[model samples]
Target chain A: MKAEAFLQCSQCKKILFSVEFEQLLRVCPHCGHHHRLLAKQRITATFDPESFEELDKEISSLDPLEFPDYEEKLEAAQAKNGATDSVISGWAKLDGMKVSAAVADFSFMGGSMGSVAGEKITRTLERAADAHCPAIIFCASGGARMQEGLLSLMQMAKTTAAVQRCRENGVPYISVFTDPTMAGVLASYASIADIILAEPGALIGFAGARVSKQAGVSKAPSDFQTAEWVLQNGMIDKIVHRREMRTTLTNLVKMLSWRLVKHG
Target chain B: MAKTWKEWERPLIEVEENIEKLKQKAKASPEAEREDLLKRVAEFERRRDNYIEVMYSRLGPWEKVLVARADQRPYTLDYINSIFTNFTELEGDRRFGADHAIIGGPAYLDGEPVMVIGHQKGRNITERQYRNFAMAKPEGYRKAIRLMEMADRFGLPLISFVDTPAADPSVESESRGISEAIAASMLKMFELEVPSVSIVIGEGGSGGAIGIACASSVLMLEHAIYSVIPPEGCAAILWRMPDKGAQAATALKLTAAWAKEFGLIDEIVAEPKGGAHRDAIEAAGLAKEAIVRHLKLLKKKSGSKLKQERYEKFRKMGRFLSENPVDALAKTR
Candidate 1:
């Protein structure tokens, strides 16, 4: 990388050498803000080398609503992100231990859950429940995909019902909240996990802050929806840092899977 | 009494006002002209009814949204009063405070005991404030979970009416973990051993709607609108143009017709001509019939079988193309 190339920390607004920033996995050295990672970056950061096996890679959405410009939008998102949809679904090993995994990337259409994204998430959990393996999902969504409309709304039920499969089978399901997990996704599989973890400083809530104001609720403090603030309020189990996220997931899944085996 | 309606309803209103004028003219005419005037009144009345039937059946997606949100539309409490007997109103989630947005309790369905629950929108401004305009907080969803669990325990058939613009999106709701509260409600409805029926009686908004709507049979009224977000919200977020709500509504395919066509809902309960608001009694009667019919079919299955069937119903919903096999991944380059 060129030494002259620089990146600014979005949170702290401090100039940093791009190579140094990349070395920290895009975590700001000045303010410790963890930059949102692409889905592929999250996959590589968390999973064991060569152990991730993608699932439902060919699954993509259909414009059943014949939504104007939707097809073109989908094409652009695909080309921009080098992926087919907002979510990257598959199974990967955490520190050599297998778990069903699905990582949502915000770069792809704001990580909205449309039919394909919902189908993939549901399939991942179903696979985990069927195989008696632990499942983990990294959630980073704005909400349901408004483009897909009611079909997207139904995914709330579809995915939550999939989570029930895990509950009934006594399988462990974990969800990690990345930056900006809210609305439909948070209200579904993301919140139903056996253990809920969030990255430090991630925005995790059911609704956005602007909506709070629109609804005439008292204005919230700046730290209102932050993971640390929510941790104090008891919405999630832990606020793990980016560097510690893998180890935390590995530890939690190991114990949760062990409990399942003992129950058997 | 006079009724209020949006601009989209002008066609029906014109026909209705004409019928009213013709009836008045018949009363004022002399006996010889009275007979002919009465006949014209009768003819106009028929035309008005027909107009309502056709217009409602052919309403655009955005027009459906307007009707669903119309102040005159019959709400859950109205349906409860008209359809059920021996009604009781329960309150509070017991974990947090009570949310007035959702009202529920054990009620007599015909002569049998059953649980009835729904999002209760306000009929007046003051009441709307108390009801939070039908938007639910974590407490409301929690209260619903309690009602659902009780219904399951008692082996009573559970009925839910979904109506809202989505869950309460506020700091208090977030502080109380509104997301998990709603998710728990969905999980509870999905796993219940007793037969359950959910009707989208009005505006079936996003997570708030789906939370209590995962039932054995999911139905939507003919005029109700269900979507991931309200048309306004969708437009503002997706297009950055708030005035494009009608366009968003069309693109969203939020109408009951679309829901039924996509097989997302079990059936479309017919509202009285115009809407459920126009003829509450007749609309409630039709809803009662649909409920009774579904209960008869659902009541025959054993508990575990019914539960499993409910689970599988939601498990199969989606529209996407899967060109590769699930297990062919690891070996593929």
Candidate 2:
């Protein structure tokens, strides 16, 4: 695979090769800006080729509240992202080691978590537990989807319990944060990972920095609420740039897989 | 940095000093100048009182922010320990290590067994660092979920005191599944058959606060604030400037009074003259009485009944009905 075939940073506008970018772990070598990745691209980058077997792809969203233009928004987001919901979940091999993975698509309503996203994530965790595979989630969201009202908010609880069940089953759950994780989603399961990782510069928090400011809190420090801030506060295990994500995940999967095999 | 009084306090201090100087001069100097000095002293005193009154009465949203963040105010853990007896803290998520930001344990409320949970903020810089500024990591919520489930199992009512600005948003928290922890806590709280009550003692900013707040009844301190997002967040999104948080607060309707008017809160617990910090014991006493009364009443009801009532309470909130006969009848008819 050619390393230079990947997307460029939106801000720095640098075109990057997929292989080269993957080696750099999705970070722009010249600008150091983190670039967004599609769920499919993320899967390919992390897993051995042709190793992905997706689950819960058939499930669709229900507009229970009859929120105005919600159907249209969902349709547009699905078409733009080529996914049934804001998230994609499946089983794949990281350096030939089996693992379950779920990635949220920011293109879909700012990757806001809704009922479908939560259910899909829950199912993925369950599947990983049943298969005895470690579960990995790449979270990118703007928190709960307001269009779904409280139901969206309720997903936080549902997913958290699911992850708990996974832990009880001795399945290791790792959460990887991308840019702009916030609100209900941040408050819930994202914070509970056995191992937490983030892309450099990801805005990860329960509330955005602006909301904190609006609430009369001082402006977050220049590095406030970013992955670095989270690291400083001991909230995350590490901040891995995009380009290093593949190798990092591969190494982590190899270690966990060895443990699982030995235990079995 | 600690030597200087704040800008607002400087004027008051100066006026007070001037008043003292005038009184000393009036006693030592001749009668003619003494009268003038007395008049000047009276004027300064009047100005000082007026300034204090005006400042207290018409605090801007930004000023309210300073008040909420004031370290002198009592945090959730302090109140929990003071009011509730025999709090045996439960630790860990059973899957991961425990989080220090959230404190939960079994306790008795007026001789009745209850679960007490709260966000504990550190008093000083070192403590804040230790507590992660009161923001719960994934384990905090996970720990909360475990304790809540235990309370439900043992038929104990749950009382939560909220004060954190939000959940920890660090990369480690995200990796550990912060969202999942919060979500699980929310789901568990809602489904629990046991009675649950919550009080907002400080900034109930977002899901971090709400995760443990899905209760049968909710109370807020007079000056505490709760909202979907903090004002600064709204400001950044709406005005493109993070500093426009004051405008965002006005629009978000986060104040306790606003929440009560909006029916988001069941009742507002009155604070002391200056605020809760002015009288921590009194404030805690008031909060304890309210909790005891509500818990006592709720204890008589079955878990299913409590759950139903809680569900209905949240469902009925924010709903509006016109008083005009035709408009009121239109929906029912």
Candidate 3:
């Protein structure tokens, strides 16, 4: 079969129809594995009908390093993902409550954050603060884009600074970690929210598992870096299933926004 | 020689060894030529110094990376001992156990009370294992969060020294929420109502470096290298060839000069003639002056203003116009 013809669970190795997988929100029905999603898919799953307003769409990354074939790779990724970059962001309504959100699409260059990706995220939070509402970001990244070089690395500081500004303005920020959140994104914006939530079995950490294993002197435990492990270790606020993610976000936004208004 | 040095400095080392052999032969010659031979030996020493100086000046980006990671380079603790007084180290994140990879507590810098936090590396094998070679785990970052919170509460200035290759990337560190801990520390640092300065003393590698590096002013030593990923790692990932690390370093723009020119760092602290490893005490003295200067400037501003300025400082970096204007405009549609 062609790579995109039918879906097979990477974890369970169970083959399924493409339509069924889409209907299931890309979660495997057999093993309940949450597969990575595109930015548009995540937006569709999280926001109210016809309420998402995209922002900062004109911004795109520049090859400051002039990395070999970076332009070709970026163009191909854009064509495939139907977006300028890895992240899609805008103001949206969660359960009819207005909020701003940004979602990283793993399909787009492994959801790496380059200069444009970081700018979009920062602007989203700034807009959320301006609107005096809570902000939520769905993260599914392989960390900072290597092609952008130091420019990619600076995003960690840039995005985290934006999160700080949003919070300082009394706007609540929530981070949602999906499958395979790692590196600069995780260490900066994705992990620093007032409330952090994650999908079940998501791989979340600073370094990728294989890379870390090779760099480290000791072997890691079987469950290390998994969402369940992080939850048990008391880092994140909660672990929400794919079905419950929207509701959990809705309730959190409502409560936090209400607190902001009352306190301010 | 360290493994990295043997690999990179072999050719220079061979020249030095040959010079040493000539000097020994001269010393063993008859008494008549002893004085002349001694003079030649002295001349050789001067020439060697000049040669090293030239080599240092012409060092490629990868060579700079090696210098930054040199084992003889002084770690954070050495700086603290030389620059600060009356240090009282506090431990534990209070959520999990304490992490040895990071050290922080109240200290007196030039008789002024300040909170010092830094990544701690060891000089020996056992110590390196204990300190995880200065790579902090989750608990280490959490403890940093706690100390920063305390600094805010007491109105103490914060100073952090960065010298890790990267954050501890082991599975245990990830499982225990190293990412969250780092993020939390950054957020808390921004929220803190205290003057803060961070210096890259050596290898300021990636998220591990930035975790404690969110300060009002970020300074890097002349020889230090800061990047999103280490050059070797970046080469491995980008080219799928680890041996292309030197090329990757050139591409990464990780040197202090590049970082300063790009406005990524506020200032560059110049090292002694050789490097920090050549004279750590002098390096500490220079670091002290830089930190004190920034802290004094920052102390006059109100906490809110400092926070706002810091936020804006990072927000203003890495701006560029897209080359594909039509594509960019269409995406905006």
Scored by lDDT, model 3 comes in at 0.85
At residue B315, give the lDDT of candidate 2: 42
Q: For each candidate, what is chain B's TM-score?
A: 0.91, 0.82, 0.89
lDDT tens per residue, model 3, A118-235: 8889888888888788899999999998887777778888888788778778899999999888888988888878999999999887787787798666787788788888888787
What is candidate 2's local distance difference test score? Answer: 0.75
Show the lowest summed lDDT stretch of 10 residues, model 3 chain A: A1-10
Best candidate, TM-score: 1
Across A186-213, the per-residue lDDT of candidate 2 in tens digits comes to 7667877788899888887754555455
TM-score of each: 0.94, 0.58, 0.90
Local error of candidate 2 at residue A77 (angstroms): 12
- B141-163: candidate 1 lDDT, tens digit per residue: 99999999999989889999998
**Judged by DockQ relative to the true structure, which candidate is superior, 1 or 2?**
1
Chain B TM, cand. 2: 0.82
Better of 1 and 3 by lDDT: 1
The CAPRI-style docking tier of model 2 reads incorrect
